[model samples]
Target: MTYSLSDFGSYWAGGEVLCVTEGAPREIAFTRDARFTYDPRGDFAVNAAYVQYFVPAQAVDAPPVLLVHGGGMAGSCWETTPDGRPGWLHRLLDAGRVVHVVDLPERGRAGFAPGHLPGEPILRSMQEAWTLFRFGPAEGFADRTPFAHQQFPVDALEAFARRFVPRWQGTAHLHLAAFLAVLDRTGPALVICHSQGSETAFDAVATNPNRITGLIALEPSAFPDDPAALETCPLVIVQGDHLDSADHWRTRADRWATLADELPDARLIDTAHEVASGGSHMLMMDRHSDQVLEATLGHVRV
Candidate 1:
């Protein structure tokens, strides 16, 4: 079920608007006032959804920090708590940093009407569908429980692939543009990206050059390409030792160091050992969140 640009326009014209919520499990807040748009030429043109959280800083002049989540999860994942308490959102807010989190298009409560692209298969599950249709994390990496239970139509996949995937150099640019748009209106800010979200932060720093003050990347995925592109910004890559072996951390640290060595402006702080007690990939939300936060705060400078 391939869709042309016109097909997407027609779909968007009749598509139902839905209110998506973003926050941690402790406090699930709805985007009471949210807007949606489709841009075929832009990132995913399926159109990414933006969710704004206003964190009033004690000092009116504090710069904001854009928190971006990785694939499969929305901004809410950052705040979700096993015991139902405010997650990192409150932590950042408490520390005097204004935070803005977003739900990139196609995921979360964002939806597409049926018959939009009829020829594609109607997926039995959203997770399976996402793995089959979208780029980023492979199927093996998916957390089975979530992927197995959610369902989505294949045309939605077509819309994502046809419109969104082609324009995206990687997941990083989609997020970078979203943050940049916010920064244009707000002001220069720090970028706190988790998992694959770090890719976007790296792209933003590389492309914009000094627009973002610092980046705190939690369990950043592997990027073997040009590490030099990421050398321009002060980056703190946090790796959970429990997720991978010492060799994995060593290799990643060496790569980051190599990249930093080339740029001179870049600095790498490998926190694998620091987060060794944390279970796995989702370290930012794990038991060691305080450590992660402290390490992140130490590097970010604000």
Candidate 2:
């Protein structure tokens, strides 16, 4: 498929309204004569999400899409694969659909506020990602061994690892708020979210069911506390392969299945169930990424 864009834009959304007390006046300066009292205590806008959107020249009569990336990642995940291939952003635009990709607060272009959230940032190593993302087995990370049927671009593993950013555990609410803010602008839209982002996306739909009509969850790492909230939303849960190889994914797959069973309009597409050789956790970056995406898109009417 080919891609063309009539327009492109970006913006920041979601932030906290702050109230502060003034500190004792202190002198601070870039130069001796330019010295002035710099009070660090004041109202500040903290933790806002960044969004970039593309408008297809020839548009289809369909809902615009809002993509939310997974944990320790940014909107770049949808821009291109580690191997320098086109990603979901271009693919969807090629199909005549409008797309908005988001960098959740505290990741990517979204700036983080100092001392606002608690706890130090956590960083994931390539070795950990190899196992955590199911690119390969943990035991074989040293030799860079991937699963026999693994479809992730193992050769570009280092490039992929470069995208990993520091994450905080206390930002789920912030993430949800940011997603909700984006939904406020793009209502009745299709939300395509991956991994940890799925949790926030799920809650966003639950919170704004009228605005978010459909969902495409890729290898979701978390779910909402109440499954019944998604009764009115159409959901497609797409999982990668080798789920049974590790308890981490095995448990997640089971939860996804159970959630699908509980929701009337929900379905699960586990690659492991569909083919002998399936995809990895990074479905959009996998070799069969396009096919997986097309299959999932088929379920989204809006």
Candidate 3:
């Protein structure tokens, strides 16, 4: 109840803030299908611009795994699949491991900024406008009993990174220049964030620790109050014990397991009993998401 950045851009441009271009795509298909496209007539993009991949079909030379979704859901939640086959982006592309999926910054196809409000739409009990257009827009703000918590007025994420980070300045320097241009074009690799994009993939590997060689934070929501950029990498804190009884997600997983116990190369794999039956923070796309992708490829292949 404290919105004020032009009243949160006029209540996200007066449509009660709901922006979603398109979703539900990954109809199960892997073994290579990349597409990180962009510039969809740019005006702060968002007409489902692009960001989908599913590489796998073995053939090593690993080092390139950036899934990073979670928060309403997109990038088809790592190309969701279970009984139908090929999920976890084809198990990190069979294990050859070179997968990068990102549809962050407000849901998939990533395009929304012409008077805003492309997602975060809610309305469950107001006699249901046909169940809010058949629960579209990412299941209509993911039915939190008719959506109640919407945000995006921290200067509209710095006016959406000065219209998609190309030379934009301010909004924490365009989120540190889009985290150094996605780790200088996807660095050393291995980062698998879910839930709040694990706080921008742990601040893009803690502000570029030589472009990450490891990290698998599945349920992270990035509650930074100077966690030393997640105590400087090598993390593995997966959570789901019912979001650990939500006292601010167990105080940010006990402050990231107390900064991974003073960082002896940090690690905290609390799967919460393999996601105790109902891990619905989209559970990485449910059915225990291959046991959270085999515990995130056995800790990103050691």
Where is model 2 more than 4 Å wrong at Cα?
20-39
Query: Could you give candidate 1's per-residue lDDT for residues 1-302 as a string of tens digits?
Result: 11112110101111223333432233333466754542222222334445556554362355677777765566676564433445676677666667776555443433322222224322234444344322123443344322221221222333322222211223344355655555565456777777666666676666675677777776565452566665656666665532233465456656656655676555454444443342344555555565667776776554
When sorted by lDDT, best at the front, the candidate numbers are 2, 1, 3
> Any idea what lDDT model 1 has?
0.51
Candidate 1 vs candidate 3: the TM-score winner is: 1
Runs in model 3 lying further than 4 Å from the true structure? 1-49, 57-66, 69-94, 98-100, 105-109, 118-191, 198-219, 222-250, 253-296, 299-302
After TM-score superposition, the amount by which residue 175's alpha carbon in candidate 2 deviates from its true location, in angstroms, is 1.2
CA shift at 146, candidate 1, in angstroms?
A: 18
TM-score of each: 0.59, 0.93, 0.26
Tens digit of per-residue lDDT, candidate 3, span 1-302: 11111110000100123444544433333337855433223223222223443444444676777676654445664664423444677665655655667654434454334334333442123223213211112344334232222111221222222222211112223233443455566557777776556666666666676687778776566644456665546777665444433366567768778767766667676654543444433345445667766765666444
Q: Which parts of model 1 have CA positions greater than 4 angstroms off?
A: 1-46, 109-176, 222-226, 243-257, 260-272
Q: What are the root-mean-square deviations of the candidates from the true structure over C-alphas?
A: 14.2, 2.5, 20.2
lDDT of all predictions, in order shown? 0.51, 0.87, 0.49
Q: Residue 232 CA error for candidate 1 (Å)?
A: 3.7
